[model samples]
Target: MKNNFYDQNIHYQFPETFWWGSAASGPQTEGAALIDGRKQSIWDYWYSVEPERFHNRVGPEHTSDFYHRFKEDIKLMKETGHNSFRTSIQWSRLIPDGFGEVNEKAVAFYNSVIDEMLANDIEPFVNLYHFDMPMCMQEKGGWESREVVDGFVNYAETCFRLFGGRVKYWFTFNEPIVPVEAGYLYNLHYPNVTDFKRAATVTHHTIVAHARAVEAFKKLNLAGKIGIILNLTPSYPRSQESGDVAAAHISNLFFNRSFLDPVTKGEYPSDLVELLKERNLLPAVEAGDMEVIRNNPVDLLGVNYYQPRRVKARKEPEPENAPFMPEHLFDPYIMPGRKINPHRGWEICEEVIYDIMVDLRDHYGNIPFFISENGMGVEGEEKFRNEEVVIEDDYRIEFVKEHLKWVHKGIQEGANCLGYHIWTFMDNWSWTNSYKNRYGLVEVDLKNGLKRTIKKSGRWYKQLAVNNGF
Candidate 1:
């Protein structure tokens, strides 16, 4: 029944050069967290003190054992028809003390991974940071301190000097705003503080850090593109009413344009800056910080679209003493009978992908970009396995096909979208959520020696890539 969804469909062919692969990170996939001079990261420290905060108390130390199994994993990646893949260099692993001598073991491991991927015809897109800050840097006030920013710049330079020749695409950060919102504002991440002002400071410093990295990349003259990955959640109004429209606009200004404008336009959105300033929530900026940000815009963009943000006007005024939050400006709007991904609690709005592409085409100069991360995460997937032991994830296949249809429409309508990479290649540890929500083309059976098995969707993905589309 599920397979019939693809029958008699209009062929959606992508460009011959479209990238087909997935994204993962060192901390999330690479086990051996405490070996070969790799020191503690914020995740390690957080899990140490507050194990209860993580799902099932499963920490980040021993994830998928990719450190020892990357060869096998890379082979699996090829089996899934990956022409390119994105992963991050662990800051804690590279420079265990946050700044100083390079860890030779770490260097060797990364060199091997890059070489192996190249050998397999996989273009490696290396990212510098993925929310895995070195513990030593966090102790120095994380992104709130200039010194740590400088350290990150040095680390970026080191990575460029070492692996720049092979890596033609580099990213400064993955979802840079997540640390600010999760760690500083929402208390969902490490050092969970709930202060808007501090969050604002972290946000500023992170941009500075990213720009500095971009500056470093430019100086090195590496023959590659440098960019950042943003999990873009397009904001939608509950109704066309003026109040709801205003609320949605405000939400977009705060969440989307705050980082999007700065990186792409090389300046923070004027409206966002004024809003922060009027509320006395703007962070202190150094004299040259804006200059750096304005000068070093990204060369490409990676959009991770999981859900759309639906907002409406606040139903009531905030309490006089209540602390500020993004929600204070808007209220969440739950549309009746909206499709949702139950495991992740996110709306499954396939058209939003096209909306994002149209937005880029009309407003963002049609920047060269790709679907850096998009996939479905289902809990307890073993229930869907067949007698062959392969998980028949028809829902996942439908999910990708639906999104790709919109993506193809956007391209046909003149959006500068390049390629698509799923959220991940295989199941691995996902921060505090652990392995609870699996979002992988390949299954990692934790109960069976971390074995790898391609799901039914993965088999279809190979043909999708071979044909360039479905």
Candidate 2:
């Protein structure tokens, strides 16, 4: 009976209230890294010290210039048929000291951006954190310190009191697990230190901080829904063997459930706790931390899906003296003949989106969620730009259409997914990638006074939003 809602019609339409737009962050899009009382974030500090780490040596200061041209960009958002959009308020920009008075210019900038978006009838979904930790906070031990957690709660409560009236959707963090893995476990991001204990501590404290923020939001009686954005990479096993299946489950526990469970279920999975305890790697926690997590569950969820993870049982034992890590429990498995996005070197597995929604329905009580970020990243997109000042991104069109079909299927089957937003609104600096891969429906031409032209995919997305589906 639930599936009957999806008839045999060739054209699939969505509910009239569905959200349509894209997602981006302030540091990645706004270029005023120094102006308007904006101090240094970890990205700014890292780039200044080691410029070579960034792609083409392009730093965060050279973003799409959205800081000054936000009015024009907001117009572009409306032209592209966006009913809702997601962006972050930079912590470094909002409070230069990370615990000081709010900057008036920063306040004015955010107020104008939110007001402009509202004037254009585009709902502004404001996120509090997006990997842009203030340099001052990092100086005092970043997420590893309980003091930093308290500072974060204060920041969140201030934002709620300041802007909760206008913004209906607020997320505590975007892809919260990435910092744990990238900054602590791997050397991919800033403060590149590979320590299992530190990684575990950071991961634990971050989730606890999110729960605390939710607690504060509810306590303040903020007139909005609050949640955290998590990047869910559906883990697949190499085969049906118990060892392989167990490896996949472990991988999911670390990458997906590390944040998902605490925010939604209020406690860490016992199996994960047992594994960490066996290795003496359990993070430091206080007496009432569990209660804080237990009492406050998110009202909504923001899911960022890009690629599925394929893992298998480890083949070799770890060196006796090697640093302990998650890979000790599982290894990567690259399947043969898997569909690939050659442009980005990531697998193109659209069905995983449907599988994720099904898991949420059957296992997680079907909590309300949305695809906050999903889009193809293609390098050398300029090669596709044609004579009419349009970037013909047909591959991106195919990518989005294929994913939406699975989303439609999940919604028809009664999954509580509310809407879909792409990975980005326009091409912006992507961390170390630094605009190497373009994932925008509208192209930002830096060579032409930072000119923005709607790509072919942007026009088609407008049509799909107008039709409610394709």
Candidate 3:
């Protein structure tokens, strides 16, 4: 009844040329896990043992079935007006055992997926890791062991040699800090060891693995850009008091700058290093490790912005013998009237995205980057279906519009942001959350054979992609 095709894409129009697509990890979307010689990722093993931990008792193996239906999915990508898409080659699927002979079926599957996207004019942005480590690797100390680091390098090298010509954009890891905080500190992920020393060690080895992968890519003179994805939470303080400000700074240093500095600036923040030294928590660094990190920086950066971290100065000294943590330096404080996503409970402060971009521009040399993942999830979205049977997710449309405006502002004020991709392409199985929270333009019906339907937001995204903004 109305012509609103270019309504959102205009006004805050993006650059004439930029990436337009969504991001998905292999474990979340590929369901033929045990079909093609694919071994168990930690999520697989964890789900098998503790299905109660996962929402609805749905496991990683029960996703959108991308493994068997990527061709049709690529057609949907074209319908949604995507020029580029991002996904990972599952480490567990590729190597299956982490450090052993490669699975030829896994290689062929990825090859076909990449080719299918290209055949449909959808460029693929490939990431090496997305929190789905082979269970065998986890059993062998995971990221804490140098052996895993070597295994990671060999895997990366193999990927380069196999798919470098077709895939030009590569990321070493996605959200490396999450596993450190969840598994080691908060005990939210597997091998839940609440040891600060081991967490620090894992963080160091992750950095090493990323740097070595970059080194491998550069040494081969590959034809692609290699980088890492970081879910950057801009730390906000309640007041401008020096103490409160310092607390926020400490939070940022410990979380954001921990991996950001070494990947982009070639080293960790001096203050953080000193703080670790004072705590006797500095990770054991080997000869040439720092050199590798310092010498090899990423060619691109992936920014996954979901929410901001708000903190204030600690009111009292932390209890003695309380295990060491970044939280000990600051206290969580809920801002009085911050906006929030009703379904997900995450605060919706779109301005923080601009804050991160500005900081990167002013402090980190304005590196080429993109908004890799940003979206809102609403529970039970099928209730919104109109007479046409399409899920009318207008709230999602508004959520994306608000964020894109900030992206436009960043681009205007001098942040070298290149693109924006939503958190997902379809409603698929999230690791622990499963499908409880729907964050896709396309809704997947789990009760009915995983039926896929394009929501209203999907059509809007098609227009947004065609218009290159919105």
TM-score of every model versus the real structure: 0.98, 0.97, 0.98
What are the per-model numbers of colliding residue pairs? 0, 0, 0
lDDT of 1 by residue, 112-182 (tens): 99999999999999999999999999999999889999999999999999999999999999998899889
Q: Model 3 — TM-score against the truth?
A: 0.98
Residue pairs in collision within model 3: none
Candidate 2 wrong stretches, greater than 4 Å = 1-10
Per lDDT, what order, best first? 1, 2, 3
Model 2: per-residue Cα lDDT at residue 448: 92
Q: Quick one: best lDDT, which candidate?
A: 1
Q: Report the Cα lDDT for residue 204, model 2.
A: 85
- Model 3 lDDT-worst window of ten: 1-10
Cα RMSD for candidates in order: 2.7, 3.5, 1.9
Candidate 1, TM-score vs. the true structure? 0.98
**Span of 10 residues, lowest total lDDT, candidate 1:** 1-10
- The pairs that clash in candidate 1 are none
- Each candidate's lDDT (Cα)? 0.93, 0.91, 0.90
| RMSD after Cα superposition, model 3 | 1.9
